[model samples]
Target chain A: MSCNLTEKVSLLVDGELSPVETRAIERHLLTCIECQQARADFLNLRQQISAYTPALNTQVQQRALASVLAKQGRAATRASAQAATPEAGRRPARIFGVPAMPFAIGMLITAAVALIVTSFVFYIVFQQAERDRQQATNTQANSSREQTATVNQPPNTNNDNSKANTFGASDEAANGKQSVDQSQQQRARGPVNSESENRQTFAANARRVRSKRPASSGTALARNAGINAPLDLHVPELLPPHEASAPRYITINATAPVAAPVRPVDAGTLAARHVEQAGLLLRAFRNARTVEQDAAADLSYEKRRARQLLYQNIVLRREAANEGNVQLASLLDSLEPILIDIANLPDQPHADDVRAIRERIGRKNLVALLEVNSTALARAYE
Target chain B: MASEDAEFTMLFQEFYPSLCRFLECLLGGRASVAQDLAQESFLQLHRTVWGTIPVGEARFWLYRVARNLALNEFRRGETRHRLFDRVVEALRPRTQTPEEEYETQERQELVLSMLKGLPEDQRTALLLREQEQLSYREIAEVLDVSESKVKTDIFRARTALRERWAQRVRAIGASVR
Candidate 1:
């Protein structure tokens, strides 16, 4: 067992084993000479270690004691500090620290709340701005429409004005109160037969005055011969014989009251005057279109075309801007159905020829328009 | 100082030295670094009790903490401390003859150096048994090993130590003769 058994003996000296195991190991070592020697050497080392009793300095021990007492006191203080913490499901109280965990959490919560509040405010403002843009677009459209209507139409009658007033009030009530009503009403009158007949009468009176010219050198030749006499004239077809004949009766009847009768003009003079008079009637008839035609040409070609395109552009842009605004889109949608109705209507007289033709005439008048200009067609009967 | 820190300082002063001495033995006489490691162990204890670390399972927590710190020190390699101890031994009061002291010091160093060669589990078991005086159950708690395994590791460690010592003794004797 010599020095070989020293490590085992040290473990034995430490009393690491149960009494039974210790006894068994001890019994084996007693008879063995080398083991006995190793046991003595281990005993010598143990004795030396045990003999060196270095005392712990008193101050060091006291310091350690004080540290332990201080730790206990701090632990008690910590316990109280912990008791102040709010439990689960509780709102935290303000506490002091440089970026304390609880304070950081509270700040994070407050930041999140503030962000949500700001976002909500922005959303409301965005909605309001969209509404304002839509309202402005509607106002511009309405003004342009009124301008177009006034330029194209005659003075409105009492009945038409009353009807427009009633319609405006009713339309306002049906929709959310209108900022402006952009639609215009154009009155439609029947064929205009009476007006054309009045113009015919006026043209006849003009012919009568032109035939009454005192210089009748051509008139005297025309009165001397029968209807078979050949007289070259600019307008022989228009002067029914009676219009030229009436002036002779007037000259004969005036002879009783007159001291000296005015001398008659020559045949050439009579012929030229009648031709000039006929040309005047034709010019009047050709130029006699109602004010509405002038206005329709002005508005439809210049103002309405530009204005309509602008309105269309506004509607398209607004539709894009109102992508998610249901109210705005619906408002635009309600107005879209009426655009064709408004556009196809006439500028005056309450009749919408384009609309009536589109509905009733269809292709019936398409081929007819090739030969008939609108102004010519309107003036044809007159 | 804050009231809490002042209290903590008093507690630190009380526990530090003994804990250091205990760690010195646990880490196989790594005495020079023992104080810092022991202080670190107490800081963990303070943190745990104060709810900086969650509290619960706190009693005997310091012993476990000190043991872990010692093991961590071993793992970290105490080369500077070992060199420092060698220097201190040259200056400090010593009761043993220079020859005996040298031999004893060499043997202790030999044991510490050899500890690296052993399986980590076996070395840990031996240290807990010899230095910490931990019961089998307590050792089991710290190592998270079965009690029987702890016993076996200690036995294996002792056998390895004995074989190593015998070989060293034989080599020394042969060289001397």
Candidate 2:
């Protein structure tokens, strides 16, 4: 019981034991002298310790304690601060307080360059397409301008009318009447003049006459007669010299000339036969004269036939004359600058070349001027 | 309510100083910290006496709370030691002889030095029995050990302290010779 009482001494001082337990330890302590002495010793020691262990107000001592406390708590303080996160996943953890700048700058520059290059390529393609479209428009405009020019051509001049007369007669001789209308239709295709059509008609007539004879005599006669006839004759002065050609030259079936020949069929008799043929043609001409005198009694019918022929010739001539004028106008339009250049100023690098250029310019200008002035002359002939 | 206030005032006046002094001793003689724990204990007691706490046992509850506070302070640091010492000095009679006071202080130093030499469990058991006056069963409850274990630990603590005190007394006698 005393052993138990000794263990209860601290509890008795603290009053931690229940009333029943306190009484038990107290009873045991009163009976046990050793336990009582042990209790007194414990009390004395505690009282003494109580004196020395208390804190007093000492500034120097408190400061020293505070320093030690701070040093001990520093690690825990820093760790707590680092662990405090308001929001997470906003930024990557910095390695050493430095950010990733190089990669981000490179990405921005690459994006900008790609945008500029794309725009530049598109600009180039669009510009090229615009230029092609402009060129096509210019070509279409030029073609329409040429068509308008053909529709607006004027009447024929004297030279054109003369050439047309030759063309119509030849057209009659070749295709007869069909070529006359066809020639007019050809005139509507472009601003061709009467002279060019006449030239073409005469050429066709000559071709027809040669083809029917199978010999060259008729061609020679027609050509020679055309030179001496009236201005209304179907003649082109620029006729081909085919009569002088080897294939077209007459082949005489004669023995020899008068001096060398001893045979009955000789060159003199052949020559006489030719003279007889000439006489026969002269008879035909006289008979036509006699018929012309007799036609004075019935003039209106004959006059009407002549006028009908003339009108047909006139129609052909007008279209043919316009065809010639169209060719000249095209040439003039191309050479317009040359003519204007010569007339406006005389400066040129080569004197002779300039003189030649001046001559051609003068001739084209003269032809254009003469044709304009000679419209009345052409009307008079018509 | 007026009567209750007067009763509360009598209880506060009676217990405040004695409870502070007892807490100082229990806290290894640190008076400033002991006073703080004592005030907290008194507040808990006040709440219970006023019917604020729902539990029936008020006195036992206050004693348990105050004892736990003093134990926790002692475990926390040596700062409580100075607080307890100062409180004990203030509580002692001023008319006591200087020699007696010195003898009492010397004995406490000797006991504390001997406690430092013992293993922690033995020192704690002896302190609870000698200073706090806890019974073997109460010491067992506080230490969370068997009552027999507390008795054995306290016996060993007393034996070691007696041997150390004898050695010190012999050394003093030899010096006198």
Candidate 3:
């Protein structure tokens, strides 16, 4: 084991191992002194190599930036000059050679249009400012509520307090009825629907992650990730910490839909849904194999939801933040085939397939990420 | 246009240090060359239709162009080892530093020389993988190679360095004996 696992040791250090394989390697490393020495050497080598970073001179960088800006400015000036003239040796294009009265009418119409556009823009701006003010006041409570649910939020400015009091009376009524039905179902299923269970867990975890790395990584991760946290940027920092830090577990409540407006899922929203959905799938994959082998955990809803998200992201040209997000979307895209296969399986999934799923989850370190993000969400909930 | 300028500035600030370090590794430790190439790369990006390209992909494009430029210059002067040695010597402080600092400097020089000894692709691949902490796919994107080739190149590079380190230890052991 000591001699043979040298290559595997490298893989282990690099985290190129399934949970099962990782467990095996850990157990082996406990007794293998030779392997331990190899690990030390490798670590030392890494340390020495990493120490040799080239210094960046800020003067050179500033100079470079100015050069770039000047170049861009020159190009833009050229473009603008070209745009100013329609053609050489030709008069300007016109709709017609009409009377001065018609030109006066056109001027009046243009003035009216401008006035209307200005008014409309002012109204939108006012609404946005008003919403921002309201959000600032409710930041505390809404942040706490974030633990129990993540919504298909309509722009952060869509503070539903006014909506709950005003429009969409029928929509609220329908949602209330659905909530009742879900509550009734939960009663039958026992305490599995404990609303604050996940909230309390994630909230605590968020605090822990916040405490662990207070400076660079901690703040960027959205430790107390608000309900309206945007995945618009493919910030690896915004994702769960990818460092090989030990992840702590906390309970997160299932996202219970409340009386909120149901915005239709666009491509961006669908990708956001998958990122959310990936967390739950990772958590489920971690625990499912151990629990009485009840393969049909009724993930049919999530399966369908994830499948819909997949279709929307792919078919609708869902612009991810970047190629990093494209990779994530592709991972989610690959999950559709797996979900379809999982749906077709019998009540109790075959052990082999379950192992395959777990392996996929472990290889991606999805469990750790799920823990990291859930912890962050819990902190946000607080 | 102001927003675009700010965007370019932000990208420059974020990537400048890492790009310079990566270039230094590729161009055999010439810090000035690394700085120039990195600036030129960013300058090229600034001149491009950056809105059409993804930021991550744009970063890889910078690395790719810098790599090509370095390789071209290397071809012009077939003395990569001499270049590496010159930079290492120049970078070494004349006055004595702490024992730890000296050891670190020596280790860094050894690493650069070991890096110099490897094939160009293997060296580039290894540095991208370990130094920049880029994923194999990312290294592949930057180097314009297949993912499998990136993996093989990294593996070969690591093995060579490991063997060299082992050889050094064995030499020290024999001398002591």
Q: List A-chain TM-scores for all predictions.
A: 0.19, 0.18, 0.27
lDDT for each of the candidates?
0.41, 0.43, 0.53
| Predicted structure with the largest TM-score when compared to the true one | 3
Quote model 1's iRMS: 37.8
Per-prediction TM-score, please?
0.33, 0.29, 0.46
Ranked candidates, highest DockQ first: 3, 2, 1
List candidate 1 segments past 4 Å from native: A1-382, B1-22, B25-29, B46-60, B74-104, B114-116, B132-134
- Which ten residues in a row are the worst by lDDT in model 2 chain A? A145-154
Arrange candidates, best lDDT first: 3, 2, 1
Across B1-177, the per-residue lDDT of candidate 2 in tens digits comes to 333333343333333444554555455445567656766775545533443341213333555577777667657777535555555456544434889767766765565566667766776666556544446766777667897788678766665665576688799899999
How many residue pairs collide in each prediction? 28, 39, 8
lDDT of 1 at A90: 60
Relative to the real complex, the DockQ score for model 3 comes to 0.16
**Candidate 1 local lDDT, A1-382, one digit each (tens):** 3345444554575565678867876986877676665556544433322222111333433354456556655654554454456652263332232222342344467577867987997687666655554444433333322211100111232211111111111111211121111112111111112334323323232223223322111211111101222211122112244443222110100011111111112222222222222222222212222244443532242223323533653454364344443432433343333334434445552324433323432233321231222223223322
